[model samples]
Target: MKTDKTIRTHIVFSIAIVASALLEPCANASSIVGTKHDLSSYTNSSGQICIACHTPHNAQADQLVPLWNHAATTTQFTLYSSVTAKSVPGQPTGYSKACLSCHDGTLALDSFGGKTPAGAGKISGANNLGTDLSDDHPVSFTYDTNLATAHPGIVSPASAAFVDTAKTVPLFNGKLECSSCHDAHDNQNTFFLRKSNAGSALCLSCHNK
Candidate 1:
């Protein structure tokens, strides 16, 4: 027969085992790495996901893209503007341009790794954002306190509430871009949003409304 102390130790060990199992990382099926973003359809492929967007060596030296394997978009976009919008947006830069390289639907999805396939693959369906961005949310815009002051609905990116919070909207070089609202690598949230927008939680993080 076990003593009371032995019974307690057994219970504690069982609880620890359960807790570790619960803490283990589960497979994310919706993540971009293995989803449709994985360019396995193209010829001369090694079946590597990161190869679609990145290479270990001989990457473009001039672009800001990290080890970029794909060609950057040259299409000029019609930016979003509104009478109430305080921020002045420029041409898409940084990750926004990287995202548009395929999303703009002008370039082939398989046109990467310093090779352009014949009749190269292209983005279709609702995912295609195209070059005309007048309807989409404005990107590549500085989102500093000045803009927040000009537009009372927005919270400053520098504020402690946003930066220090667990649910934070990311900015690129003090600017709001496509990656700000979306996380291409993780899709635990719908639409690859960095956090759940349920009840407008993500929107309210940046917008006071």
Candidate 2:
């Protein structure tokens, strides 16, 4: 009782299923869909992942980041300081400030889309960097040939935009920042690191020792 039309429909369905299976790996390879940063669970959200940090239209103009959706943090952070260190870091700026909007404990994870959060869920435990940044690795500082020449154990940067010739590590406007080592979108490496930290390989990329 097999009709020609029924057989053709079956063949088309089978092809669609096979095509979907082939494209799934590509989707899972690089996306923020299931990552910790995906905050689409918010009840008021559009149920889209990128809406947490980006918008298609009317993004905040004051924010240096492209299409910024989250409210900027206004905390006057206590920066890292050292007597021997040559790099004099001032206040946190640009991308580092963007990351601190949630990590600083001042803003909720759902503090985006220009609406107040329903719950006070904040970045806690080790994920919270807090207002005091004395202990953490120094960010939002200029790292160039001048700094490298003056500072010990620091390697000279290939260019203002990137740290390595491979260009794996990036700098925000010639300054090293939180995003320099971390890639916000891809979590293929844990902690959202740009590369594996095994044996401090990521650290060695910038630091000579």
Candidate 3:
């Protein structure tokens, strides 16, 4: 039989230990946890980390995507308007909003998660890519799948691309997602593109004609 004081002390200690363990993962998850974002290197600010873009959290409306912060862009983006473009924008669909959350330059990159550094750390810094998105090709809508419907499928059986044997990355009916052409990690192609469509091969991969 222990005194009430002894029991209370033990309980308090147990709670403290459990709390610390739970916080361990949260602390470790951040690449720029306590340390401020390096101004010289352009690393993300405090509380923002690699997990900010690639984790399990509130995420975006797309649901297919991983963790994301920053408000999804609502303004109609300016795209590369030309005859060569095979897609047309009707309202951004699928995870296209999530892709724009970063690429569109409307939202600050470190707005979500926890605290971020003030002043120079803001994404609006001259070097930080901002809302003028005209340079990148348009990405809100789906591509012309009818053109590639005739090709023999080349994707692997277990690959995500194989679910619809006839479907292709460039031909998805839904909105084009960042994942459509890029795999966030360990990409063999430059800019994390899913395949080597460099130069003309990239365009010809789907637009066979």
Quote the lDDT for 94 in model 2: 81
Task: Provide the global lDDT of candidate 1 against the true structure.
Answer: 0.80
Clashing pairs in 3: 197-202
> CA shift at 181, candidate 2, in angstroms?
0.4
| Candidate numbers sorted by lDDT from highest down | 2, 1, 3
lDDT for 7 (candidate 2) = 97
Cα lDDT tens digits, model 1, 19-96, are: 865543244545565445556555345666777788889886646578988878889999999998988999999989
Best by lDDT: 2
Clashing pairs in 1: none
Better structure of 1 and 3 per TM-score = 1
* Model 2, span 76-195: residue lDDT tens: 988898987889787888888889988898888877878667547887888989999999899999988899889878877864423343366877788989898998898777678888
lDDT, residue 28, candidate 1: 53
lDDT tens digits by residue: candidate 3, 40-71 = 13334453345555446666444434555434
Please report the TM-score between candidate 1 and the true structure: 0.81
lDDT of each: 0.80, 0.80, 0.49
**What range of 10 consecutive residues in model 2 has the weakest lDDT sum?**
158-167
**Model 1 poorest ten-residue lDDT run:** 21-30
Winner on lDDT between 1 and 2 is 2
Regions of model 2 farther than 4 Å from truth: 1-28, 43-46, 159-166
